[model samples]
Target: MPGGRLTHGDRRRIAAWLAEGLGYAEIGRRLGRPTSTISREVARNGTTGDYAADHAQRVSGDRARRRRPARPAEPPTAEQPTEVVRGFVDRFATLLAATGLPRMTSRVFVCLLTADAGGLTAADLVRRLRVSPASVSKSIGYLEAMEVVVRRPDPGGRRERYVVDDAAWLRAWQADTGAHARIAAAARRGVEIFGAGTTAGTRLGAMGEFFTWLSEQMSGSSLTASAVYDALTVLAALVHAGRPLTLGALAGALDWPEDRVTAALDAIRRQPAIADPLALRTVGPRTYTLTTRSDRLSQAQREALHR
Candidate 1:
């Protein structure tokens, strides 16, 4: 009964509890239901001061009657069991919700992530999640704003489908790192406001430094993580060879395509001077070497070494 759908009797008790001015948690404890369940019920029905249990019960019954009948259970497959996938979606959505994503938004994201087509229409999400179309639409907008989801025209219909592809994570990372940059700026402002000599200012200064370092590390390049990794690998190869290598030679040595090697080198060249300790130099046509920058060391470290 604790986890089952709320009955008309439950609604009546909730109305009575609201009349008594009891909080959601207290009502939930008395009813053996979760606080969220109690809160959602009241919020859906009406406000605390004007809840009508009978009306709420009638509306809920009508909505339930309008819903499509449940489909027959499919047999479990060796590759992907239906029950297993359902459990995974639920658990994953919960984990995402814990990370500050709204509960319904997390559910919608998990649904899209697990969809076989890698995309889903709002109708599909509503049916699968058993949520209203409005909820699905709102979640989609939130995910799109974060660049974690993209909408494309559905091939089969006029309705658009939402997709979360490989590049979605890269975009999400960039968006999140952008927030870190803003936070670093705010911390710097705090340091200035509090005065650098004060305790608060010192803490803010350290926080600003940490966020700045973190933001730089994650947002050094607009390239995807894999591209950055490939660039680093190319740099490592040059370091190990201790000499300039032709594109062909590097590609052969790394067992990668020549184009991939070239792309990696190009990525390294595009990095800002402050973002990378190593620089790519061309000593001969189509040949490249990695050189450590003299300014790689901090100013204080350079001064210490000179002394």
Candidate 2:
């Protein structure tokens, strides 16, 4: 409430105003900002207990970063260089596929995510991805469905471009919960295929129930997975920020075992969340992280749900 920016400061005062018995119009009049702005600022940032100034500031900062330095590309490289660069797409596509996304789908999204502007219209995508407009359209539609990226109105012209935000992967993470639900349901159905009384069925059914229940707890319970992911993400960010952190440091902070921390890191690293485990180097005190195929159960769950 004390330190605030335009959209944010206006909110802090508005909350206090409401608590002190000031109406929206009264608060707007007092702040000299529009009533709608004040209303939205509070509505968006206000929590059950408090408005969370730190959270508000982080959101505002993220929004600001999105608006900064639009597409400052390296001096447009020689056009011919692209021929050489296009070959890299295969490598890029391979990396994407390894992360569980389709090859073309991975390439298309990665190209957009890493774009200097963090955005590209369909035409730009076609040119960059070296694919027909149809291919771009199809891949982009899937990416949009996955919430891997989002479309925004282009300031330059009529074309709407898919723009990657700072929270792009977080959106991707949010989408995973739904995918997990489908997986859990499918796993439950697998019990019948393997015979409910058999070991496989019993194991698969339990797997399905556990994943479904865990996902629900994380996503729909009082404490959301997104919140936990956010906190861990900050810790991950700090680690990647070049400050050396000991495994014990995080263990003390989260009150978790070193091996447990390592396992969790391995899980996330295997997932598309980390992209590179090297960034999470201290996962087990100098031991390299291992690749994991954690979705085997999730896939079983998805199949079970359909049954």
The estimated TM-scores of all candidates read 0.51, 0.42
Q: How many backbone clashes does candidate 2 have?
A: 9
Off by over 4 Å in 2: 1-88, 189-196, 209-307
- What is candidate 1's TM-score against the reference? 0.51
Query: What 10-residue stretch in candidate 2 is worst by lDDT?
Result: 270-279
Query: CA shift at 153, candidate 2, in angstroms?
Result: 1.2
Instruction: Identify the leading candidate in terms of TM-score.
Output: 1
Cα lDDT tens digits for candidate 2, 211-269: 76556544543334654464355345455444655556655556777775555554454
What lDDT score is found at residue 54 in candidate 1? Answer: 99
lDDT of 1: 0.84
Compare the candidates by lDDT and give the number of the best one.
1
Candidate 1 lDDT tens digits, 1-307: 4668888898999999899999999999998999999998889888899999999999888888789676787775322337667688789999999999999999889988987654888988877777899999999999999888889899998999888988998888888788988998999999899987789987887788678767877766677788888888888899899999999999999999999998888777765332267678899999988776543554567789889
Worst 10 residues of 1 by lDDT: 75-84
